[model samples]
Target: MDVFRSMQIMVRAIELGNLSAAARELGVTQPTVSKIIAALERDLAVRLIERTTTKFTPTEAGQRFYERAKQILEEYADARADACGLSAQVAGLLRVNAPLGLGEMHLHRITQCFVRLHPKVEVELVLNDRFVDLVEEGVDLAIRLGGALPASAVARDLATSERFFVASPDYLAQHGAIEHIDDLQRHEFIRFAWLESGATVEVAGPDGSRHIALRGRYSINSALSIRQSVCDGWGIAMTPAWLVQDLLDDGTLVRILPRWQAAAQTLRLVYPSRRYQPMRARAFMDYLESEIEAVPGLTTSRPRC
Candidate 1:
């Protein structure tokens, strides 16, 4: 039995919860994955998985082995990368996760440039609207838009994002323009549902930083949806200025209460702690930070140190 390959396959199967999915991720056939798992189980003389009609559960022994297997696989990858001079070259698969709107608008160009600079590097961009567990999801890095991150991860500020209260020209013409925060209560608001708690947002405006309890005619978790609704004259929304810059410039959307600014959210480049960050991972983070710094509104232009 190829013990290492079997271990890798089993670990991936446990993570993905099925053989077919694991096979697809590993670039192998389902039968091959099944055979490998079966062989490994027979050799070990322990049933690693409990398969039922509806689900696959790892046995206690399976869980223990999987934990060690992941470490072994990661170490092996690190050693291989080091041997190939990847420590000196930015070359490998970089798995990155970011908000869908930011990924489509901002990250796409940066990723293209990074790939151009390092032709050997491959980037897997997962544009998810929901917050993902980087360690559990096997992501190398994530672009987070908010304040400081949890202590479990290391973060660097990529930019300071300014929030704007905006509405479409048609919506303002119909509902009349809002000159103050209190005016929001008189109109329909579109809220972005928090991913962790599915709860609607009660945002604070700049004046007195008073929390405004908003009522949305429609609520969704997607930033894109909120932008679209505002564009369609559904309602006024509080969104990041970076997202609506083009719309504001082109007269598609107009900013209300332009003199008042809401709390700024920091754009962060977050990754697992250094202990867990491999050379390839660090390289990707470095590339991302450099690229983001070059973008307008992220930071003031300065000579590279």
Candidate 2:
């Protein structure tokens, strides 16, 4: 039996949660995939996967083996690339994930430029506002806003996103000028759906951070929707500067509470913790880091250690 080939099949099967899907991806028949997996189990004298009619999951031992097998496959790929004198070549499918707002506003353009530089590389950009399980979702890399890092992956700080309290010029004209912090309570706040922190909005300034009670007539999960709602003269929103920079510049939106801003959020790139990452992934990360300055309202400077 080809041990290496079997390992590849098993790894892909576990990742995809279906032997047939793995077979399709690896260009083999489903029966071939099942036969190989059965052979592996018999050889090891252990059941590697716990499968039901609708569910498939790796056992504890299988999980350990799967992790090591992935590392081995990466190492083998790297060795093959070097031996074939193709160490510098970047050719493969790279799955990238990012939030809906950032993905639509900047990541699409960045990916366009990246593919132009490396024509051999193909990128699948997945955009959503919900939390993503990187390994389970088969994502190669992810660009995420502020959150604690999971132990399964390594994170690289990319940039800082400064947020602001913004509203349409028409809304401000109709609601009267917001001359002080206390004035915010009288206006409607287009809140994010995920934020269940009551009606309070947090602001940071020279005096320190504080939360002030606010009213909201509307709420949505998407950042793009929030931006649109604000632009359509719905109400005020505390949104990321990157999301509304163009609107502010074009006089479609105006920044409120300039002296006190929402706490800045860090943009990070996260990927599985493999010792040997593919040349394609490394090159993509480096390229994205270098292009940080191109994203509006995001600063390249990280905080001093």
lDDT of 1 by residue, 148-245 (tens): 57676788777776786889999999988787767878888887876442323334544445556667758888888888999999998888877787
Alpha-carbon shift of residue 109 in model 1 (angstroms)? 3.4
Error of 2 at 283 (Å): 0.7
Ten-residue region with minimum lDDT total, candidate 2 = 296-305
TM-score of each: 0.77, 0.92
| Model 1: how far residue 50 lies from native, Å | 3.3
Error of 2 at 133 (Å): 2.6
Model 1 vs. true fold: TM: 0.77
> On a 0 to 100 scale, what is the lDDT of residue 213 in model 1?
65
> lDDT per model, in order?
0.78, 0.87
How close is each model in CA RMSD to the real structure?
A: 4.0, 2.6
Superposed model 2: Cα runs more than 4 Å off: 302-305
Q: Write down the TM-score for model 2.
A: 0.92
Writing each residue's lDDT as its tens digit, candidate 2 over 158-198 gives 98878879998899888899978889898888988867685
Error of 2 at 234 (Å): 0.9
Best by TM-score: 2
